[model samples]
Target: MPVTSVEKDLNTLSMTIVADFASPLQRLWDAYADPRQISKFWGPVEWPATFVRHDMATGGRSHYYMTGPNGERSDGYWEFTAVNAPHSFEVNDGFANEDGTPNDMMPSMKMKFEFEETANGSRMTNTATFGSVEQLQQLIEMGMEEGTRSAMSQIDAVLEDLATFAAGKGTELQILSDTQVRITRVIRGTAPQVWDAHNEPELMKRWLLGPDGWTMPVCEVAQEPGEQYRQEWENTKTKERFGFEGELLESAAPYRSVTTEKMIGMEGPSTQNELTFTPVDGGTLLTLVITYPDVATRDMVLATGMTDGMETSYLRLENEVLASAE
Candidate 1:
């Protein structure tokens, strides 16, 4: 875990937070630059953030929102003032509506982030300036200090995920055929560990759930060819449940597996999934290819935002499952 310290200056109407992470400066910089990575740690653990739009260049704008445990959402936007890759950036940050319109009633602030290489890892300092002492007090009263500190503490976890995805691995989302889509990621773990994470019910329960407030109530896996597997997840608060069950078409321990998937509530054709795991320098390169019956069906699944869900799930797999293996 990282150490985050916040200092508030009422006279200057400013707050500065400094944190040291046991990760390389470039890794930390990349995490902030990538919107998907930003979503992993931009908020506290309980309230996760989802980035709707991200443009990391000078004069560009970014819009995102944080979703609370009870499904409440808080929207915000950032207008980039300057961007120095792997070093620093400046932004005007403030609250926004669902349509990304700036909220006039909210106080806007200027934020600057600086990253420096340290002996063990990297050091980052964030300085935020408010218009007046009253405005600063208003934000502090809204739990900004505690929220920011809690968010900063998750940087190490995000850094681990970024490192896994950056290890000469490419995330390719391609339409292999009219009815097929392929997604791949080079994960950081041995072949055996990766296999366990996918095949073991206990390990699968940890990171298989896509988002924060969801839990896998039922997870059953039979790791042999012709065996059946099923997984079910529910929103703990809403009690809404959804899942899929499939039978293995091919199974090879620590290497490859193929299955036929029929989604529970989704009406359509079943999908064929093939997973290949290969040993890389320090981990395994896992490639997943899913095939549908027709282009329209594939497009329909894509419209359901499966890519983002899978990406987030894989990130959790790296941070929680693979990191634990080490």
Candidate 2:
């Protein structure tokens, strides 16, 4: 996750993980195949995870990404290998284009998952082989496996919770929580310009929201607590409007604004939104995070194509932010 503009001076560890769970082979297989199932145990409990497209079949291809607790992103490709169901499958994977063409520059690897019925339940064996021995060794030296195992433990816990939830077992959504979303992004713009792009109400309307027709109707934002922002979201094609009344959770001028969003006609747990700006050469790196209180609500928002909407908002912000590079 991106440390907010408040923690501008602190360092955060961005980690990648892999894990296996003990469940029925078909159950394990379904988690790898279904987007909704993937969303349930996809990440660090606070963030959101959603699939872009998935084709699980022999020689078929897929692609998906995850957004961080703070709206950071990471996505990769889906390659299918040996796809006999309830048995074994493998893939040559990496961040890829919609067509499943891998990003050649990024580290790509081979992943083989094996599922077998165990006396207690089932065993899933995952092996990720990096292309180079150096890379593999490098990951090992950095304790990659340990982190992967921890994340997997989280996955296992959630799976158990899901089982309970499925069997009419619990009320609280806490039983299942995993890291959600992978992050991928970069920013380019002077710090001041970027800050303006995020904080100025009218400015945000132009690039971040769109023309007045689809833009936020009333945006009231304060860079500090006890403040509020009256922002409205409208559908460009359908004229559907969603309203958000938010209290400034935390505000650091020209750096960040964190808010608690309560959207009209939507209930459950309210959503928390945060935006941060960091100065980079010739620009400021902007990070946006959306956190949901429960996995079910998070899943619902993700299913609504919230990630795509957020991406569009960020791109617009970048265009405006970059205009002031000097």
Candidate 3:
């Protein structure tokens, strides 16, 4: 998502971003919520930031300084308005001193970050409300839009690296070594988040086929061996349901999970999938390996345009996650 001052009201500037990455919503949220990952990419390349006092709470404060390009330097402090970790965060941005005194010279502003996951990807909204017309003008003069676009590009790089890195490692859930179709995907979410995405109807609707008139029902989940998960996809237009079931082949909460999924709509043997998640430096890296029985089915899936689809999806997810983190 290109960062444009897409919407502005009064003296406030607002922007919308979409990021889709292989990662699930939870891990993406954590990266944004954590102070460590945030300090890395918060500001521009010229304005490298360092966190001084980061107490992330409802009334907490985050005071950071940007080493100015010229002799001019500034320190900013954010007073938390709300801290809904992994979902939404809003703050009051005010220039402050090292001693916690607000700098009256700089205008006060209210900044908000909201995250939402959609079927195709995830979307983020950022709003910065300036104190006066002068402050808004200052931001425009600074070329905020271009600066934001550059920052977002860095975000895309991070997301792509995370996806490729996760896929390169991790254990196979289904373990179909000799299968012809090499259904390989790195799971990019925690075991619990993935489990919820696969289990909960509403959450699944957000990122799945809900908007497209596809219904997934008759779904079940087994936490242990022999535990079964059965789900059916019903085409709203045709009124046809393709029932699918998978045995809980492996399960590790907050870590990894795999299931053998079999669908009735598609012919041939059941497609087995193993979803793996490993905790990396800052967040979880996920890989999902899928194996189809015959070459025809594999060809069909490859022809379905999944590579592009997944790329777009993952990019959007990453963007949204990183945006909300800011």
CA lDDT of each candidate?
0.80, 0.56, 0.57
Best by TM-score: 1
Listed per model in order, the count of residue pairs whose N, CA or C atoms clash below 3 Å is 0, 25, 19
What would the C-alpha RMSD of candidate 3 be, to one decimal place? 18.2
Q: What's the lDDT for candidate 1?
A: 0.80
How well is each residue in 229-323 modelled by candidate 3, as lDDT tens digits? Answer: 66666787898776777687766454445578776556556776655443434444444556677666766766766555454434433344323
lDDT (Cα, tens digit) per residue for candidate 1, span 1-326: 57567898988889999999888887788678655568788988878887655555576677788989999989899998997866898999999997677888998899999999999899999999999888898999999988887887777778887555575554556564587676766677876888889998888999988878999989989677889888999999999999998899987676667899998777766898977665544466566778788888899888887767776777889898889777
TM-score, each model? 0.55, 0.42, 0.45
In model 2, how large is the Cα lDDT of residue 92? 79
Which candidate, 2 or 3, would have the higher lDDT against the true structure?
A: 3
Provide the lDDT at 119 for model 3. 69
Query: Which RMSD values do the candidates have, in order?
Result: 15.9, 18.7, 18.2
Model 2, 224-255: lDDT tens per residue? 69876677777777878877776888665565
